[model samples]
Target chain A: MLYFTAMSDDNTLYEDLLRIRRFEEAVLDNFPKGVFFGTTHTYLGQEANAVGVLDDIHSGDIVFSNHRGHGHFLAYGGDIRSLFAELMGKTTGVCGGRGGSQHLQWQNFYSNGVQGGIIPIATGMALAEKRKYSDAIVIAFMGDGTLGEGVVYEALNMASLWQAPILFVLENNRIAQTTPIEMAVAGDISARFKAFNIMVRELDSSDVKEILPVAAELIAEVRSLKSPRTLILNTYRFGPHSKGDDIRDKHEIDQLRVERDPILIHAHRLDSNHKEAIELKVEKYIQEAFNQALADPLPDASKALTGSINHQ
Target chain B: MPTVLYALNAALQNALASDERVVIMGEDILDPYGGAFKVTRGLSDSFPDRVITTPISEAGIVGIAAGMALRGLLPVVEIMFGDFITLIADQVINHAAKFRWMYNDQVRVPIVIRTPMGGRRGYGPTHSQTMEKFFIGVPGLRVLAPNTFSDPGDLLSKAIFEDNDPVLFIENKLLYLNTIHDSNRLSEFEFFEQTPEPNFYHHSKHNGTIADLSNNYAPTCMLSLRDAPPPVLTIAAYGYISEFAYQAALNLAYEYEVFTELVYPTQLSPCDMGAILSSTKRTGRLLVVEEGTHNLGWGAEVIAQTAENLGSRLLSARRIAALNLPIPASGPLEEAVLPGIEHIIQAAQKMV
Candidate 1:
């Protein structure tokens, strides 16, 4: 069993949250400048969900994320430079630039653009770990939009039926792209999971400190029982679904940003001097990642067809 | 006694018993239920821990199989019907087929997708259809179908252990109950006087004069002749339609005096172009037959490659396949849509 030790001066939690927030902000800033090639679903306001949940992820454990997966990738220790390189379509990227932002795959970390596709894949990975008698669990991260897909339910049923060691983290921001959750989802999400006999734990994503203890407990339960569980993080996305889709009202978005800003809330916990030092360090790190990734050369078009198909 | 269905069961049983990493997952594959087609009967009872009964989720099954394969397990997934393959096409085409190459050859998806295809059961458009054409050109996938000459047991075992790539093992519904008999077996010619001198042309590279004489199941042609004469036309077919091609060859040998050779290729995707080119060079005319619809079908691919390779040496080439339309529920309508032995004979005659 793992326990969270929050010392009075410990800044790891705050730094993790700040790194994702700052990195995504850097990506958004570079988007309009045409530095990054394709669209990226920013994990702007949902940093606590990824940081808090992935705090307990073991080294051997695997993680699968959705389209809005930059934060999950970073929180799980994905290389920031390679991630920026991937967004820029460089050969030094995680997937050698073939897979863009939505399709980032590194060691023990994978993300796909398709909704509900990774749940079953994560469950299978958990099944493999279980069969091998390894204690490593799998964490599959999805948003409220993924609940609309039928494959998620199928995966949930299998995960529960097989008692796979998987922690399904649902970052329920109550919105699916431009559409609100009320317009899309039907009934109680937790009740639906309970019907499948999976244990459900709801966590408030407004504060990383509050999310850490609960996430650690749930992770321990999944690891001990080797059973499927869910941690529904009630959060909100501060930015648009993508770069060019700011359909939400500015007044409402500003209110949520002020009331539930994860970064500010965590920063308030730190001393003034400590917060300043951490922010400066995180900013410099993000800047270096951006500059290094920009300096990297683009992939050669002549060798584009090399790894398209593998033969025996 | 070794029917196609039993041969499949034997192959699956051998895989499960041989490797601890081998696992079977599908809907209704558990014991008592066996499977939709009973190909997995008694498997669960014998290897209870390995054979997993899954929900009716094609995409989930395939996606999970891909994950398992990536994590060092040889997973054999059974998609109950061929038509349902469309449900898992994204996982098959995008994920399973692309994972090895897209991931820079770091992983091997040693997975076998076993599904029953073809339309003769009057099961209607959605259920009964030969949709193997859709998966033919997929780069990383090996699409194969078993015929009379090839044993499903051996083919499936090879797919499981020998190859590191994913294989789409298509089993025809009609051939499930059919017995596996080699026409050239000694028991087949027991009544003949002096063993009825073997009268056929074997490729110099291949030593087998008859299908039964071969020790291994490789892609090869079996020529049926009235006398020791060169074939005028080479009729190539696979899966269920190969039975029709064999019948047409025999009929042409007896009636038209058009000595014909029948080519049955077990592996269809990376088809054995060497043997096919050799046979087509000897017999300048070629007729390709398949149960899939004619428009851009497997037959089209065979003809295209043969024409490109043979060039002027190939005299004429034609293809006989199902009409480009949905299979109907009525027996006669299904028959009308599908290509039969008469269609094969007519197409061969035109080429001759």
Candidate 2:
């Protein structure tokens, strides 16, 4: 029951998960040597949320992500080398080095460093697609930490009233940069969306198999109903908030890694030899991306002076 | 004569009819009510789906508009009042303005935010304000204000269709009722198109030839009393106050014999300083009049730019702007604090 016979190939999903894992591992492992610019939020334990939800993405659909977005970007099929180059502030980067870490844009996938800001934008994009009769739904990802922003509620209200085709994904990592969700969030998170008459679906899982089917159903409902839906994924983050800022107990993190590791949970379903093959391929792929990004030239400093807005 | 409100409404109608990508979103902009200033009157009835009436969330509205613009839609958002723009500053400054540059030209936010600014009504402190100064220097954003000289509709069309950046289109609250002037209406003053060509002013100075109207979207206009003596002072102004500055110029020539020329540029940021500089060089003295507060305002910037360009050639310079104080609800207090035609005249006399 965990795996869907009609769904994506399990090997491909496992490889996708491994790619994010190895890419983030490369980021963390290379951070000490100062190979990257700006801070990064690694998706060590929360890889399943991205790989599972984005499995439902159709062409012309929009995906809006937050600061902790590398996993989501990789799952959305963003170029690994370009993402690496972007983090290194090189010319071959996704945003040509202007948007270092946290800010990335490739095709219909966009990410901003600001929390809760992308929600309204996503709602608007969904509405735009609906107006065009394109039948393209939007998937906007936010964190439990972003619940503190009042604009999220405003966007939810508008989205419900307008019947915008969007799936609101709340990745509840139980922590917001050292602050626990219980301390920061008030009342019930699901009720917040329900208050605006938006359909709510909650899940607590680290396995991509479990998340994939539920996310697919919710995404289908959003597309068919042409209305907003909230999918609150209660998850765990096994890495530092951003480059060695962890304040949680090491023993608790180690215990969570063993019990709630998404990669480990999914690896049990795959053959050992196949898992090793994916690990090796992802390792080589991530290493080549990192090395090529490191070797790429930095963006031309002179072009930074020219105004992006029309100066003529 | 068409009113400024008519021009703006026509612009909206023309944009919606011309392109399906154009959308208008605001609070209470629907039928029967139109907008607060009626600048969006008759738009919703004409294009129901395009003119959207939303909740009272300025930040959310602007944020949504930015999204729509990013996805190949030209969204023209209307903030109920210019004062309410403070609530959406984060969305406009951080998101709309920074998207193009921050994204490294991956996308463009072609949104036109139309809001009524300025005070003459008794709408109190928060309702009436010339707050366009705050958004002037923001990169990847353009600030445009239309006056009586040319068609404001033309400029709005250009902003919505031509420009690939976000434009804050300011419509003065008092100017909504004022009449737009054509060549016949401006017969008392000499009107000439400030051509975009280089050294046109220098050529005009040598030959004394008047240039015909050039088809420019937001060209600056220069005006002086017909057959008057050479200008001794140059006055710079924009938006609703530019009309008063023109009147002050005529008053100075006929009534006081000060002989001043008025330079009004519709585009504020990335301000076209060519006409202002040429007039200042001829006049030797410059005076800037604005309705915004005096500190770090539009007048200060115009003065600063003129001084930077004509350091030694500038004989004298002065800025006439509103007093640095919160606009009071009382009529007399508001009038006393805001810069008026008398202020421009007095400032011109002193500079000359």
Top lDDT model: 2
Q: Please estimate how well model 2 matches the true structure, expressed as its whole-model Cα lDDT.
A: 0.86
Candidate-wise lDDT, in order: 0.82, 0.86
Q: What is the DockQ of each candidate?
A: 0.27, 0.45
The sequence of per-residue lDDT tens digits that candidate 2 reaches over residues A1-312 is 232334578888899998999899889998989889989998999999999999867878899999999999999999899999999999999999988888888899999988888888888888888888887899999999999998888789899989999999999999999999889998999999999999899999999998998988888888878999999999999999999899999999999999999898888888999989988888888889889999999977777646434452
Pull out the clashing pairs in model 1. none
Residue A111 C-alpha lDDT in model 2: 90
Name the lDDT of candidate 1: 0.82
Task: For candidate 1, write residues A134-191 as lDDT tens digits.
Answer: 8888899988889988878888888888998999989999888889899999999999
TM-score against native, each model: 0.90, 0.95
What tier of docking accuracy does candidate 2 attain?
acceptable
True contacts kept of each: 0.43, 0.59
